[model samples]
Target: MTTTHISPEFTALLQSCGLKHVAIIMDGNRRWAKQKLLPGLVGHKKGVDALRTLVRFGSDHGLQALTVFAFSTENWQRSTEEVGYLMRLFVEALSLELAELHRNNVQIRFIGELSGLPEDLRKLIQSAHTTTATNTGLNLQIATNYGGRQEITQAMQALGNDIAAGKLKPEDITEALIQSKLYTQDLPDLDLLIRTGGESRLSNYLLWQSAYAEFYVTETLWPDFSPAAFEKAVQSFAQRERRYGQ
Candidate 1:
């Protein structure tokens, strides 16, 4: 696709610095599939392969946390068939890949409204979480049925509950306090956020954690986003001087 490429030296520079917590808004699976005259489900399936590649790339590059937006709460508006296929694909991936992921020392975590998932999928997620709970390698956070605003709302609700129960005082609330109540409490704040499929928007992903994150948008589709493209994103992140409003 004649996209921009980053050199190996730049990739090394990216690995050496403060790119610990990286998140991706994976977009353009269906569009890629449509261009190739393939079914939408086929595109989604290919997106899974892209995810696997990114996970391994993250681990190899010594990333502490890698979060990917897999499905949004708004995805329910999609066709029933597509949604069903996605749910089934989620189940199948967990069933087939969890053991391998565990063996690789990847700690898998699903962040979002998991209660809305089918019971079997929920059980699989729970089992995967339990199985990989102690893995000390890459922190893999998958956002299924997740939204940035929804996460903030949920965190606020938890914070309010604590305050009402006399466990916390409203006056004591801080940014750190709100963070502690979040789904990503254990993870570090986002350092770099990438959006594939030529999209520039955050699309309601990681609103709270990406306050000062460097963003790299690419024209590459999610399914076609190779390790080279990933390095390019990191390269872009490495070049930026983050002042954080200093």
Candidate 2:
């Protein structure tokens, strides 16, 4: 989709409503490349660019946090070659852009089962996290090999283990206690959840944190989801009345 110029009125409206935490389910990379008659990897690379743009935009707009669904646990079922290429691309992107990201004061974090990743890649992610931990800018969280069910299950297991060890009791399992054990404990609950590529399903994203989030689904594919598309989502969010089960 072609990007339109952002208007001052639109920006003011978004700011007025206050979008503190925004999450995105980025979809349609391979499909985008197929439609363009380009390699699938090319679409993935472009998706990375789109992420960079959104991250920068969020930071500039005074957003506190931005979480993106990157590689999901289900994505492992894809072809080995594509998965390998994605891993390599992830490492390359981190190496190439981490310094600029740090300079921009973005705190980089990865949330998922990272133990299954390559040692080199894991080390790089750790290094990036450590290097940017002190940044005061946008809290950038990337969900790689992440699943909502797995996160909740892990939290439950941790709570159970604590109870077994006598460090806690079964009665102590409150909603806050469960949230404290989740990967997103440090961030606020999701304020807005945007999905690209025309898909409307949550697809096992931040299911727990998004209990009251405003959802914006766009037909624009991930690679083609421009800043204007993001602006449009913000506009839609600004117009919503979040009753939060009231």
Highest lDDT against the true fold, candidate: 2
Q: Which consecutive 10 residues in model 2 have the weakest lDDT in total?
A: 1-10
Which regions of candidate 2 deviate over 4 angstroms?
1-11
CA displacement after TM-score superposition, residue 22 of candidate 2 (Å): 0.5
Task: Put down candidate 1 lDDT per residue, 133-171, tens digits, no spaces.
Answer: 999989999999999999999999998999899998989
Q: Which ten residues in a row have the lowest lDDT in candidate 1?
A: 1-10
Q: Local error of candidate 2 at 100, Å? A: 0.6
* Backbone clashes in model 2: 0
Error of 1 at 168 (Å): 1.8
Question: Candidate 1 vs. truth: CA RMSD?
Answer: 3.6
Q: Per-residue alpha-carbon lDDT of model 2 for 148-200, expressed as tens digits?
A: 99999999999989999999998878999999999999897899999999998
